[model samples]
Target: MPQQVRGVIARSKGAPVEIATVNIPDPGPGEVVVDIAACGVCHTDLTYRDGGINDEFPFLLGHEASGIVESVGEGVTSVAVGDFVVLNWRAVCGQCRACKRGRPQYCFDTHNAAQKMTLEDGTELTPALGIGAFADKTLVHAGQCTKVDPSADPAVVGLLGCGVMAGLGAAVNTGNVSRGDTVAVIGCGGVGDAAIMGARLAGAVKIIAIDRDDKKLEWAKDLGATHTINGGQVDAVEAVQELTGGFGADVVIDAVGRPETWKQAFYARDLAGTVVLVGVPTPDMTLEMPLIDFFSRGGSLKSSWYGDCLPERDFPMLVDLYQQGRLPLEKFVTERIKIDEVEAAFHRMHAGEVLRSVVVL
Candidate 1:
């Protein structure tokens, strides 16, 4: 039987989200129903509400979530009913070309529920990132569920589902931040701070944080940034170079996803240093720079999609690290909110007032 639950939804573009009746159908073959414990308010959710992602209106607007599996469809052996799990957008299809090449992290085909959840009126809703979770229950492919230590805070570990994972993966996976390496992260939002945490976890010697907000910079310090640069007050590239002993950081990550921030990341790295782009940019954004500089830089420039992470592998490991006191994942949850508070959380996020506001179900 389908269940009717309260959920946040963007009924139309550029409109505020509302708590409405969402119908969650029972899991079909290869699907599972999750009873969400906590769902984090992400910038991506706001983007979807603003129509930045697509014309998919009436979007069920949260994806970074942690939940308990309430039911599993036939043949679903990966996760069982009553398991605590984090929902991941990227449910790799093992037969895809990327997965066949042993790089499931870059799997070209991902999985979502084959069946649709609907409004009270039976209108189909589009799930954000294919895992709409700002509700009491959500339906997703069984592969989208990643089991983690149930002891961890749901509000905190749920972040590993999206932005936090992207930032951490940008440093540890894409940038390959290592012991004694100097790392610089541009943007001190949740993602940028996660990069700082990732660098620290990877044993980076010096971590420089760049952002316009002093509050975020302070938060960066708590996350292990060795230095902070106010991009609004100084030439961030120059400050980073000076802080890194006249060269620059070994790895510079752009978490703002703008051309200006990208250029700063490009110039803020030492010669032959890596630059990782993890921030999402709008479709109209374009980058232009000297082609010669690309050759002279002599290092990799990479874009991270979901931090190039494999949920099955990275989610459990990260949750364990968070539970052991090695990773401060809880700090990402700046506040806990009710489902109806998602719009206010979006405003807080836009005002640079909170790293994350999670809805506790």
Candidate 2:
């Protein structure tokens, strides 16, 4: 029988989300039903609410979530009922061209729960990142539930499901920061701060965080940034060059995803350095640069989609890192909120007041 679960839903674009009854069906083949424990409020959720991502109104918002498997559909073997798990948006299909080429992280054909979760009035709901999780229960493909250390705080560990993963992977996976390397992350928001932590985890000798806000730059320090540059106070490129002993950082990541910041990252990177763009940009945003610079940069300029992460591999490893105290994932959680507080959380996030406000179910 389908269960009526309490969830936050956006009834229309630009409308505040509301707590509504949603029907989650028993897992169909290859799917599983998760009883959500906690979900983090991310900017992506706010984007969906503001119609930044698409016209998909009535979106079931919130994707950074941790939960327990209550039921598994046939052929689901990745997890068992009762497994504590983090919900992931990318459920890679092994048969995709990317996966077939031994790059499952780039799998083109990811999937979600086979059945549509619906509103009380039977309206189909578009889930944020295909893993709507601001609810008591949600459904996802079997591959989406990555088992983790149950002892870890659900509010914190769940973050590995999205923004945190994107940030961490942007450093460890895309930028390929190594020990003794100088790394700079522009934009000290949650994603950029996570990049700072990831560089530290990867043993970066010099980690520079750049932002306009002093408060965010200070927060970046708490997250392991070795240096913070107020872009509003100084030219980011000049500060980066000076901080790196006249040479720019070995890797510079643009977490703001704007042309100006991207250009700063491009110029602030040392020759043969890597630049990873993990920050999301709007569709109207266009980047213009000298074609010669692209050729002259001499190394990789990569855009990471979902941090090039394979949920099955990355999520569990991140949870273990959090459990082992190697990654201070818990610091990302600024507050715990009720489902109805999402709008307020969005405001707090916009105001740069919190790293994350999680909803505990």
Candidate 3:
């Protein structure tokens, strides 16, 4: 039987999201129903609400989430009922060229629940990142559910589903910050701080955090930053260069995703050092830099997609690290609120007042 549950939805562009009754059909083949335990109010959700993602009206928002499996459909064997899991947007298809080539992280084909969740009048809702979890229950492909230690707090571990994972992966996987490396991360929000933590975990000797906000810089310090730079006060590139013996850091990560910040990141790394872009940029944004700089610098410039992570392999391992008192995943959760307070949380996030406002279901 179909189930009716309350969910947050963006009805139109620039309109505030509202709680509405959503219909979830029973799982089809390779699908599963999950009882959402907690969901993070990510910036991507706000982007969906503003129609920045697409003109898909009535978007079912919320993707970074943790839940328990309630039921599984035919051929679903990855998880079973009662399993605690973190939801992920990427559900790699093993047959994709990327997967076949041993890089499933870049799988060209991913899976989502084939069934469409709808409004009372049967208007189909596009789930944010194909995992609408800001509700009592959400339907996702079985592969989207990555089982982890059940003892882990959902409010904390669930963050691995999105921004946190992205930041960590940006440093460890994309930036390849090895031991003794000097790393500089710009933008000390949730993602940026996670990158700082990742750099520290990867044995970076000096982690420099750059941001406009002092509070965020403090947060970065707690996450493992050895030095901080206020971009608004001083030239970020020069500051990073000065901190690393006038040569710049070995790896520079731009988490701000703006042309100016990216340009700063470009020049803030030593010659032949890496620059990793984990921040997302708007379509209208463009960069005008001298072509010769790229040729002369001669180093890797990569953009991290979902931190180039493999959820099944990364999530569980990261959870274990958190449980062992290594990763400060809990620090990322600044506050917890009811699902009804999502709209207000968006405002708090915009003001840079919170790292992450999780909705505890």
Q: Candidate 2, residue 336: CA error in Å?
A: 0.5
Candidate 2 per-residue lDDT over residues 207-229, each given as its tens digit: 99999999998999999998989
lDDT of 3: 0.95
Ranking by lDDT: 3, 1, 2
Per-residue C-alpha lDDT of model 3 across residues 58-158, encoded as one tens digit per residue: 89999999999999999998899999999999999999899999999998899999999999999999999999999999999999999999999999999
Q: For every model shown, what is its TM-score relative to the native structure?
A: 0.99, 0.98, 0.99
Best of the two (1, 3) by lDDT? 3
- Kindly list the per-residue Cα lDDT of model 1 for residues 1-361, writing each as its tens digit: 8899998999999888999999999899999999999999999999999998999788999999999999999889999989999999999999999989999999888999999999999999999999999999999999999999988899999999999999999999999999999999999999999999999999999999999999999999999999999999999999999988889889999999999999999999999999999998888999888899999779889999988899989999998888888998988889999988999999999999999999999
Give the Å error, residue 227, model 2.
0.8
Which runs in model 2 stand beyond 4 Å of their true positions? none
lDDT of each: 0.94, 0.92, 0.95
Alpha carbon lDDT of residue 38, candidate 3?
99
> What does candidate 2 score on TM?
0.98
Which 10-residue window in model 3 sums to the lowest lDDT?
49-58
What's the number of clashes in each of the models? Answer: 0, 0, 0
